[model samples]
Target: MKKVIVGNHAVSWGVQLARTEVISAYPITPQTQVVEQLSEMCASGELNARFIKVESEHSAMAACMGASAAGARAFTATSSQGLALMHELLHWAAGARHPIVMADINRSLGPGWNIWTEQTDSLAQRDTGWVQLYCETNQEVLDTTIMSFRLAEQVNLPVMLVLDAFYLSHTAEPVDIPDRELVDAFLPKRQARLKLDTAEPHSFNALVPPASYMEMRHALQEAMREARTAFDEVEEEWEQRFGRRYGAVEAYHTDDADLVLVTSGTVTSTARHVIDQRRAAGERVGLVKIKMFRPFPTETLRAALAGIARVAVLDRNLSPGRGGIFAEELRAALYDVPAEDRPQVYGYVLGLGGRDIRPDTIDTVIERTRAAAAPDREDLWVGLLGDDGAPATTGRAQTSADSLPGVEA
Candidate 1:
């Protein structure tokens, strides 16, 4: 059914249709509405599931861990400090191989206690051993949530579905909610290939000697590598049923473009608009939207970026000393490609703390990147100011190791 719905509600419906057997969460804006809607659905008998009202985000995840360990498909949602609170459990969920899926509304971390959009909160947990997917729209949110479950369960890892807090979470848009019957056909009951079955009487979180610890870590790494294809196949089946296709990355207008822009979450939508407008004016520009963050889609990114003259990476999150988080990842992804196949890359840190990124700003980023294609230059930061009132540009070869705090490179 087609309806105007906010991103959070869209995700809520996705969870509903997925028939999640367990949900545990605490209220934290702008993510609070997601849990609220699910709570109402549970109370009204619209969703037949166990809704555990926990006192805090930490407890919420703890409850989810218990539920998932008990052989139920589990889920949760939070942002910023709430996500921070759930930190220890985040590692537990992934390490336990519980197949728990979560929705993290990307909000800025605060010194002044702010609740606004930023990518730092999610990026901070990059090493937590979870498969992360960043959504560009409400439709993507709905679709990715379903795909996340399939991927997580297949690899026995957790998945984090991330979207911009206010930009996509609160904003309403036209979304096609897939029929419940169709979703049921696609994702049936959560039958575990390797679940904590009390009947089987197995010990999870078992103590391991040093002899097996390294091998266990290696096994987890192998599973993550194998999950890429598993993720692709799940989406293929979903697209065949829903008439929409998604993957680790989605490229737009890149076939014949000289310049490309890469981003995640809601910024991809803004970048797409600018690409379309510029295409109308005869500019050869395109965009690449990264949906999967970890299990880093390295080869896919390299293939998409190959042959482009220049590429601009606009990240709403910072790596503190480094300019843009996504940009740094992109450079790493392209390391193995021949130097000529590599494009001149520009990095921009914008939209942090709910800062606005107008279409003109996107256009300016692309234009500047194309103009600054010096062979020796390695990195440039657009839309950020330097100490001397200049646009921020750093040598691409340097990794911001010596960067000072509050200073743009």
Candidate 2:
């Protein structure tokens, strides 16, 4: 049935349908509703599950790891700081090869304190060896939630799907809540390939000698490589039954285009409008929306941008001294492509801390990319304060009401 619901509820619905046996989470902005709804489901008997009200994000993840290792389907949810707290256990779950699924509502990290959207938190954990899938809409959130479980179990790696703070987490949209029978058929009971069996005691995560550590790490890497194709097959099976399919990377009209705009999360929606408007004006421009970040879709990206002359990567998250993380990865991914075939990729950072990413902001990125003499590795701030963090006297630095829509000085 199709009903209008916020992204958080969509996640809860997906979890319920997947028949998650264990859920452990601590409340944080935007992500609180997801756990709250799940708790209610558990209490009301609509969902048969164990809802663990853990003390902190770390404990929540630890509980999930334990439950998952005990041969149960486990899950959790969190935001910026909450996600940061779980960083330690994030590695544990991946290293143990536990198929735990988590929903991270992307929010800003701060000294000044803000609970708005930013991808920095999850991106910071890039080296943690977890599968990351970023969703662009509420519907995608629900569908991805269900599919993530299948993918995680298939590869024996934890999966984390991200949603923009308020744009996605708090907003409402129509979502097709999959029928119980369909979801059951799609994602049935998980029979652990390995588990904590009391009858057959075995050491898990025990001390490993230096000689054996490298081999274990290599095996995990091999699984990650296999996940790339496993993810494709999972989604293909989903499309066959559900009539909807979103690839690891999604391309919008890149065919024979000279310039392309790259984005993830909600920004992709706005970029699509910009692309449509530009196309009407007879411009050879396109948009590429990345859904799966980890198992980084190298070959998929190469094919989408193979012949393009220039590409603009707009990142809402930053790496401080380094440029946008996504841009850095793209540069490396395209490095081996023949020099003449690789496009000059520009990285633009914008819309941090829940600030809206309007179509005008995206337009500026494309304009700058077209004018730049060479690919800029340094991150360029798209919406900076009017000069010195005060009112701008003129030009693009103007921090006037018109300059910052819905922003109060």
Please, what is the whole-model Cα lDDT of each candidate in the order they appear?
Answer: 0.84, 0.89
Candidate 2 Cα misplacement greater than 4 A, ranges: 388-409
Q: Give the Cα error of residue 274 in candidate 2, in Å.
A: 0.8
Clashing residue pairs, backbone N/CA/C < 3 A, model 1 = 378-396, 379-396
Per-candidate RMSD vs. true structure? 3.8, 4.1
Q: Which candidate has the highest TM-score of all?
A: 2
Report the lDDT tens digits of candidate 1 across residue range 125-209: 9888888899988998999988888888888888999999888899999999998899888888888766567678778888989
**Cα lDDT tens digits for candidate 2, 196-284:** 99987777899999999999899889989998999999999999888888899999989978889999999999999999999999999
What residue pairs clash in candidate 2, if any at all?
none
Judge candidate 2 at residue 107 and give its lDDT: 95
